[model samples]
Target: MNFRRFKIGYRTLKTAVGASIAMLIAMFLNLDYYSSAFILTVLCIQPTKRKSVRAVYSRIIASIIGVGFAFVFFEGISYHPLVFGLILILFIPTLVSLKFQDGFVSSVVILLHLFDSKELTWSLLWNEAQLMAVGFGVALLVNIYMPSIEKDLKSFRLEIESLYSKIFHEIAFYLRNGDSDWDGKELVEASEVIEKGKALAYQDVENHLNRRQNLYYLYFDMREQQFEIIERVLPKITALPVNISHCYIVADFMEELADHVHSGNTANKFISKLDEVKEEFAKMPLPKDHENFLAMAALYQFIEEMDQYLHIKRSFVGFNMKKKTASKES
Candidate 1:
């Protein structure tokens, strides 16, 4: 296998091995009560450096809440199976909706099992909490020693870059060859990738919510805005009566523009292409009627705005800043 592919496989193996070792150690200590909680809390959490810590916090909090509820109920009622069943009905759904509900549920069950005993008291709660701490500590080891956030983010960025390249290629083909069929397919495919990209990017943000400098959130939000702008342009571009050659040329320009943006660089090629497209519009023979002129004018307007969006992207990381300048112009 290639180097990158081998690294991915190696990482997966390392994670599996680490988690297995953790499981065995927990089991040997008879800490099965917290085994599920540890895995679920850590697994559902995004694989970020921060989440390793937050997962511990969330698990601990949820455990306390669950055990607290169990203790209250058990103290109030005797250990009747029917009462336990009823409590289950009420508590299960409530726990499931919680952010770290999986861990909480396990904790509540442990509490219920130990309920109504004379041994039940703050001391027992402390003991359970300590065991949970051990489990959480184990999970943290896996996260720290076998972290994959850097690898995950790099992979995600590569996928986005690849998709951007394909989108530009499709656009170019349509513009240069006037191949409506291929351009249509390309646009559809690119849209699908954009949807997928948005989902992945959002996941990246959620994984890092507890971190201090969450640049992933900013990057994801920026991509979302760009997705919106492109969506608006796709239909307009498709509807234009121009031949495949014009479409491909425009697409080629867009591809180059997208590359510049992806690299976080200025879109000089995009600006030049915008002017070229404008000249094309101006030189085209007109129907000499008001509505036709209006339609042509609208097309130019869209292109100009799209160009402005690209320019704004070149200047900063978000639409919020661009809005200020647009307001100033008005």
Candidate 2:
């Protein structure tokens, strides 16, 4: 395996701490099933505390199901290999159909332990309950404080905006010069960056239980939309039949737009600038030949893309940016 990519995170520390604490407490209390506490702790810890929170309920429910099935199998039927098979046949399908499949493996292990008990009794069922409480309780307390993703989210934002600026600068250079050294590798980088950013942004949102809004997600969403337009628009830029003098007007506009990609504010200025370009296009002579026709069509499409891109930025202006409200103020 690639241990080179492995780095211990806060979540790992949390899980370890929680499991150790649960085990210690169980040992002190001298519970009949002390191992269950540690087992529960290991199962409950999630990469994100929110995930732990969500999974806890399922773990509890699945434990109940497993214990319940074990009780029925031990008492209703004989404790034979065939009975265990019958229990699985009923248990697996029922859990799946209920959409509680996440607990299936854990529940199976739990049932196996109960199956090997010295005697089937109410105390056995009570022991399982104690394990569940210890495990789920430790997980809940440990996950109360989630680590912040603000720093990482900021890095993604800066990188995304920087990439946008580079792409726009390249596009303008290509439009005017009809050539560029850049191969659009940044599109691939941007895709990975944005996908990761959106996921982290979502985790950031999940960390805050009461806050429903997600600014970073919206920010990435806007960039993702712009990314789509840019991929479509970039290739056509080099093919325009116009020279530098003809492309100069749009070139200057693009460079100016590039400067403001990270502004994250109202886009009135951008909208007005695009309107001016559209007006200029309106007065220009219509394309008669195929080459000019394609160039003109590309120009029109580029304008529309820019307009939509600017609007997406505008949509998140007053909302959260990087998990904080007052993005416009920023």
Best by TM-score: 2
The Cα error of candidate 2 at residue 116, in Å, is 2.3
Backbone clashes per model, in order? Answer: 10, 0
What is the alpha-carbon lDDT of model 2 when measured against the actual structure? 0.78
Residue 7 alpha-carbon offset, candidate 2, angstroms:
3.4
Backbone steric clashes in candidate 1, count: 10
lDDT of each: 0.55, 0.78
lDDT measured at residue 50 in model 1 versus the true structure, 0 to 100: 60
RMSD of each: 7.0, 2.9
Alpha-carbon runs more than 4 Å astray in model 1: 1-55, 69-73, 89-102, 116-118, 121-123, 145-179, 195-224, 241-265, 272-295, 318-330
Q: On residues 34-126, what C-alpha lDDT tens digit does candidate 1 reach at each position?
A: 454345433523355465676667666766666655656666775666766766676666666776664554455455546544346666665
In order of appearance, the predictions have TM-scores of 0.63, 0.90
- Compared with the true structure, what per-residue lDDT tens digits does model 2 show for residues 57-117? 7877877887778778866787787898999999888888877777776687577767778
